[model samples]
Target chain A: MNVILSLIVSSVAVFGLVVIAFVGVWGAHLEWLFGVVIPYLAVITFFVGMIYRVVQWGKCAMPFRIPSTCGQQKTLPWLKRTYVDKLDNPVGTVAVVGRMILEVLCFRSLFRNTRLEFGNGQEIKYKSAKWLWFGSIVFHYTFLIVLLRHLRFFTEPMPFFVPIIEKVDGFFQLYVPTLYQSGLLLGAAATFLLLRRVIDGKMRYISLPADYFPLFLILGLATTGVLMRYVLKADVVSIKELTMGLVSFRPVVPEGISVLFYIHIFLVSVFFAYFPFSKLTHMAGVFLSPTRNVSNNSRIVRHINPWNYPVKVHTYAAYEDEFREKMIDAGLPVEKGAPEPAKPE
Target chain B: MYDGGKIIAGIIIGLALLTFPIWYTSGRAAPKPEVKLPVKEKECVQPGPYMKKKHMQVLDLWRDSVVRVQQRSYVAFNGKEYDMSLQNTCMSADCHAKKSEFCDRCHNYTGVVPYCWDCHIPPKEKPEEKH
Candidate 1:
């Protein structure tokens, strides 16, 4: 039932994403709404939702040490245990940060992943699978670069470095029309990653339709952009005017801008709006993950549970005094004076 | 174990590999032909009201005769005019439409800025008419 419910929810979400992409791309006539208003709403929702989620997580208590560890724990000076895991001192914390850098930048865990399967002759086999990791790294890094390059669009006085980046990106000299290295790389990497999920039985089994939907939507956007570049050329002057207007918050939808342009913009808009709600929310969730941002200073400082309660106390001495007569009757030693003459009742 | 399911899976994968290229190339089929004009004409004149009423007809004829002939020519966005045979138009927006060449020539010469390529197709000679 849980799986079925998740499938349904993921399907609905993906379907909604597709609709949003289409509307955004073809709906240039409604640029003010999608380009300006929707983007504004998405930004607000992203911040508010992220803050809400982070605050909620902060309110939850963690009374136990639950840091996911990779190396050995620090103990006994000569034992050679991993200082990063056990002591968690400042230097050790830097080691953790170093590990995170490789994980975030290169998808280190993914690189270490292996696939287990039954081979010929009923033999069990484990095989290293690093293609997924490679594709993902390429996709993310190229995406970051492409996004940074787009900063040229938002700023008035173009930064000094943008031209240098543009020249470097077009260094391939692939055709009479200079080709953008990252653009092609981004598309190829995205395709490879998507194919891994669809073509690999194991990945497919674990994937919800939501996983496939974002991949497909992004693929659509990439394909359409390539088409605009290499095939059905559209008006550019009008496009820049429109884009400039949007960034300046004085949007004016140009008359001749093609529907394809709208489609590209729309897909991007959908990506932004759906970003905070979907698994893609990892963009924000990464900052909120307790494992990454929380300090690992368990040794230097104490974390007292604020919810601890006060209770009545009893000591061993009190117990002994209370049972002094009982102990003597039971042939046990007594702490105070022993037997005496019978006194008036 | 020579399991039947495993064999079937392998066969299915093999079949998919065979058909993948076909699907990819089919998507790359040429776009519909755009309206063109004659090579002899230096400037494309706006048509009269009567001729404008039949714009589609004029466009069809112009696309066949003029655009098909001069389609091989290329233009650049940089402030230098290079023959189409020497340089292929890849990223420039100046030569996107029929009137775009004039814009490209001037903009390329003057270094005037324009953002015509971001959303539009880069200009190219008609592939089918190459021969």
Candidate 2:
């Protein structure tokens, strides 16, 4: 039921975006609005929303030294130290950094993820979940390359490196236009991830519409991009001119650029605007996560809670000053006063 | 514990920063450079509308053709051949005599900093006296 609802909602959102874009560009003929104004607005929303979210995350106070460690901690000197296994500060901070690097770039933690397989009462089995890790890594790297490939349109003099990247990305030369490996890989990864969530009972139970939305949206974006590139030969020249116009701050609604271009641009704009508010912010939030970013050095150094404050401290000096006679009569040690016999006693 | 005011202020500031360019250029249109006709030849390689929209692209093609492809002549849409050199094509007596009013006007409005001027000198301040 959840999956159905999620699918329905995601489908509607993607369809709504397409319909709006088609109408805005084709029906209304607001080329400037679609091409220039919305693009600019989306860009502003992306940057501002991203910065605001990040700053909000930054300001959050983590009162605990909570580094999610999976292996043995720094213990007796004789005990073997598992450097990467959440142990012994991982041979100083470099090991921690290496761990983080591995975690971020390679999804090492997810690579090591294990799920409980069907088991008898006597024995339980933990199975490796490599598919998730593989899908994620492939998806991320491909997305990066695809983004880099787009710089050709945004820059002038065609920055020497961008062409080189384009050449490297299109090295497969599989088709007339030279198929990009990333484009193919992105599709495969997105499909795998979506199917994983849909088909797996456990994953489906946990999945929300927010999770499915980006997947379907990206699939739409990638599909349109691929169609434009390989199937529909849009006007590359005027497209570049229009893009250059935007980048150079002299926007012109160039003639002959296809509506497909507008749709692609519109979807991309939606992605940009939606990114900060959605789970997509894990790209930045991952770096700010205390469980991931903080060091596990509680034994070596005290982790004080910056938010912790003393409401009222009762010092011995104050107590002694206030109850000096009482303390002395009660046989409690006094700093400066002599004890006197109590009349009642 | 939420500081509503602080959060709102941060968001407001962030929004202001991001939308600065849009608001800055609000109510302003792209600066249209003044087009002047040359005394020698009135016709360019392409029509006026085409040139207005795509002169940069045409110039880029010319730059690559002459500099890299070793092609020195340009065949226009009208089937007339002209020098591929920008120095000859763009700055000659038959073309606009001054780059300041003609070229700089559009470039300045668009704010596109061209690299052509880095290597190529401008047309001499005043056309040399015909010998």
Candidate 3:
């Protein structure tokens, strides 16, 4: 039922985006909304939703030492403890942060992952599982670079670095039309990642439609974009004009922009708006996850919950005083007056 | 041990069966023909000033060609033909020279980023204009 619901929601969302983009591009009357208003709404939703989710996550209470660890805990002085794995102090916390950066940026954990199996005659064996790591790294890095490169679209004074990045990305000079490296890499990486989830039994068993939907939607966007560049070849001037109008809030639906461009833009807008509400929120959630971000220093300092309620206190001494004769008869130590004095009372 | 071995083999085969579709579907499912370069016209017929009566006509022709090519080469959503002639033009060396002037001006004015400049060669610099 969960899978069915997920599939239905994702399909409707993606199909709706396609329709919106089609209308924006082909319908002469609808261009203003698609070209300008929808994009603004998407951007606003993306920012506002991200902030709200992050704040909500911040409000969560983690009252125990629940930092996920893979190494020895800090205890005896002579024993060596892995700082990054078992965050014991400030220095250890910093080391953990560094490790996380590598994991997030380079997908280090995925690289280190291995698949275990039993081979001929039931001998246990381990094989390197690197493809998932490779694909994830490529996808993330390429996505980041593409986003950074797009900074040119929103800014008036073109940054000096934009041209430099453009040159670097197209340095390979693959064809009559210079190819942007990120675009190709993004497609390849997304493809590999999707394939891994679909083909690997374990991954496939756990996969939801949420996983497949993003993959399909992104692939569609990338395919259309590549086509625009090397195949159908849309009018660039009108495209820029349209994009600029959208950015400046006085959108003038340019006449010559292709429907494909509009579809691509609309899909992108959907992705931005959906980003904060979906599993994609992991992009922001990672920073607040207590398991990842908190330090393991429970021994060093007391962390009392500020919201804890006052409670009645009981002591073993009081109990012993009340049952001194009984405790003595039962061969336990008595903490108060003996049985003779209690009888007089 | 034999049971373990069987389980391992089953898992491997299962994984292979699962991954095949994703790999197969990576590229375009139905491949289309690659775009062919335009045959160079031998006559150096100069188009008029940017947005001028004659220049607009030539621009319109160029725009029409782009629209026609896009329509022929790609499929649009909603099954409607997209006329590329209505889209903006570029005046920079990046896009074709005759139609780009109008595009460059507004893009420059609004500070819009053009992806074409990233993927295509800039037009060759024209010689200095006579006073």
TM-scores of chain A in all candidate models: 0.76, 0.91, 0.83
lDDT of 3 at A125: 91
lDDT of 3 by residue, A159-217 (tens): 56666776688787564345789999999999898778767767867878878788778
DockQ of each: 0.03, 0.05, 0.04
Q: Mark the regions of model 2 whose C-alpha exceeds 4 Å error after superposition.
A: A85-92, A119-121, A327-345, B1-131
Model 1 chain B: worst 10 consecutive residues (lDDT sum) = B86-95
Compared with the true structure, model 1 gives a TM-score of 0.62
- lDDT, ranked from best to worst: 2, 3, 1
Answer with 2 or 3, whichever has the higher lDDT.
2
Cα lDDT tens digits for candidate 2, A1-345: 588999899979998998898898889987888888998888878887888787777577777778877767777878766555553245356766676687778877688888888788768899997988989999999998888677656654444566677667777645545578889999999999999999999899999999999999999999989987767656555676676667667788877767889998999999999988899988766655566656787888886787989779899888888999888789988887755668794
Each model's Cα RMSD: 15.4, 9.4, 14.3
Give the alpha-carbon lDDT of every model: 0.56, 0.75, 0.62
lDDT tens per residue, model 1, B75-118:
32334433332112322333223334433433332122333344
Candidate 3 CAPRI level: incorrect
User: How many backbone clashes does every candidate have?
Assistant: 19, 0, 14
Relative to the unseen true structure, what is the C-alpha lDDT of residue A56 in candidate 1, on a scale of 0 to 100?
A: 54
Q: What lDDT does model 3 reach?
A: 0.62
Ranking by TM-score: 2, 3, 1
Question: How does the DockQ of candidate 1 come out?
Answer: 0.03
